[model samples]
Target chain A: MRVLGVDPGLTRCGVGVVEGVPGRPCTLVAYYVVYTDPADELPLRLLHLDTELTRLVAEHRPESVAVERVFSQHNVRTVMGTAQASAVAVLAGARAGLPVQTYTPSEVKAAITGSGQADKAQMMAMVTRLLRLAEPPRPADAADALALAICHIWRGGTRARIAAAADAVRQRTAASRTGARPGAPGRPGPKRQGGTR
Target chain B: MRVLGVDPGLTRCGVGVVEGVPGRPCTLVAYYVVYTDPADELPLRLLHLDTELTRLVAEHRPESVAVERVFSQHNVRTVMGTAQASAVAVLAGARAGLPVQTYTPSEVKAAITGSGQADKAQMMAMVTRLLRLAEPPRPADAADALALAICHIWRGGTRARIAAAADAVRQRTAASRTGARPGAPGRPGPKRQGGTR
Candidate 1:
């Protein structure tokens, strides 16, 4: 599955695209950091971010998108910008009919580095090793974006499997009640459920 | 000038449009509370807001837009939504090429009422009295939106006057230096220095 991950911010929004499934090495497709001028009016800055994100989505056409879920624990002024930028990213994915997911910083860290409390250096080291890059992605935001993409691929794969398993169980139960073969395909259920994280 | 004021929220976004100058009694053009299902995904909710605001701007063709500036001191979760929604509203106005301004809650209250510490009921009462509405706009959100519009008009008028005065002084200074008559409109300067609040 091709996935796009966004580490959203008004000043520096990082975007990374990766292709892979769960339990497999993910391939890095591309990475970018979108920048907006702080001196610009808020609306124009947001508009610029929106335009870039929409263009990126059009270019990459990822099957799904993942964004870092912003929390209010951060510096109040910065968090608002982060939330606004994330909104644009989420809207870009949803407008394109792609499933969009958001993971907390801790969740992304735990998924990439095996610990939610891992520091930035540790996470960067893991992201470098996992993606088999020549060097660590420069400008922390880029690495964070890649990490979010990796986390989503792994977690989304597990969620998909669990959903499929639950669907199988339900199908089997329904078949037994109808006195039909358990292996037989009765009807197709929802393809996927609960895309948000 | 026609102004659209937005009290942005994920579930209930209030929009109000009015037409008038700074000191004159404003005339209400229209008012609405755009609703999005709270159960909807965050991206979907933002998309709904963007779509509605875009349509409103297109239909009304307002000269400018005003949105309430979201602060972080409010309920954390609710504040995030407010920031996101305000971002969408700002984007809509910017995309339509309208000047967009944001005012803090206190600023709006102070502009509408005599004091910034005024409560909602007092602000609504002023809004009703100022607009000469038959009744106070329904829902606190609606009244708040109208207040924002009114605030923008009054404050924007003051800002414009200040800008014009500054421009006039600069022109007179330049005229004296260049041996040209003052107020001759020599080499027309840029109009409207700033659009943001």
Candidate 2:
């Protein structure tokens, strides 16, 4: 399966596409860092990320999208920009009907280097070795994009299965809460209601 | 001026529109809370927010958009969701070509109630008083949204002018860096380059 990975940032959004399946070596298809000028307004920067990401999704047609989940950072401004950029990527993936999963930095590192504490150089070296590129990708962001893709390619399928199972459980629980039969096969489940604020 | 205010949340996004110039009493046009199920996937939740906000902007045709700038919260999950939801609102504003600004909660409070630390009750009371509503808007989120709009109506124009001046300074600095004439009228400035990963 092909996966699109996004390392989101306001000024520089890293995007990479990889083709692979579980237990197979992944091949890099395309890599890009979409940039927006810091001088630009927040809305314009967000729009730039959104338009570029949407274009990438349309061009690559990846089966799934992987985004780096934003965590609290000491620099609140940086984290906020990352989160905003990630939201744009997620929106693009949804528009393209691609399943999107978010992987934490540690998760991506562990999946790639077998250690959550792997340093940037180690991860970059591993990515270069894994993709068998003659030279490492430039601008660290590009390497991160590859790592994110590799991590998702290796772990995302299992994660998705687990999520689907959990969804089933949630549906069943919600059904029971609404007085429906618990686990009755072929029961006409009620339609999911839209949230009303 | 017409302003669209967005109080963004993952489960319930509050939106309100008001029409008036600065220093004039603003009139409420419409308010609604867009909702998305928590059980839905993150991508879907973001998509729902994007679509709803875009529709609201189209329907209201606001002259400007205002979003509550997310701050660091103790609840990481809640903060992340809020950040994501706010991104969608910002994107919608950019797409509509409307000037967008973000107001902090305290700033909104200060603008509406003359106190940065005003309680919700005070803010809501002021919203009702200013909008000349018979009763406070329901679901707290709706009231907060009106407060956001009112805040923008009172404070956003000056902020926009300041931001525009900043943009000009940044442009001049960038041009100087590139050896172009500073503020040369109609100078053929280089196009902003996209990020390279």
| lDDT tens digits by residue: candidate 1, A63-134 | 999999989888987999999999999988988989999999999999988899999999999999889999
What DockQ do the predictions score, one after another?
0.66, 0.50
List model 2 lDDT by residue over B16-134, tens digit each. 99987776678999999999999988888998888999999999999889999898753666887898899999999988988899989999999988999999899989999899889
Pick the TM-score winner: 1
- What alpha-carbon RMSD in Å does predicted model 1 have with respect to the real structure? 5.1
TM-score, structure 2 vs. true: 0.78
Best by lDDT: 1
Q: Model 2, range A72-171, lDDT digits (tens) per residue?
A: 7537657777888999999999988888998889999999989999999999899888888899988788789888998988886666566777777767
Q: Candidate 1 regions off by >4 Å?
A: A172-197, B166-197
Residue pair clashes in candidate 2:
A33-B197, A35-B195
Poorest 10 consecutive residues of model 2 chain A by lDDT?
A188-197
Query: TM-score of predicted model 1?
Result: 0.87
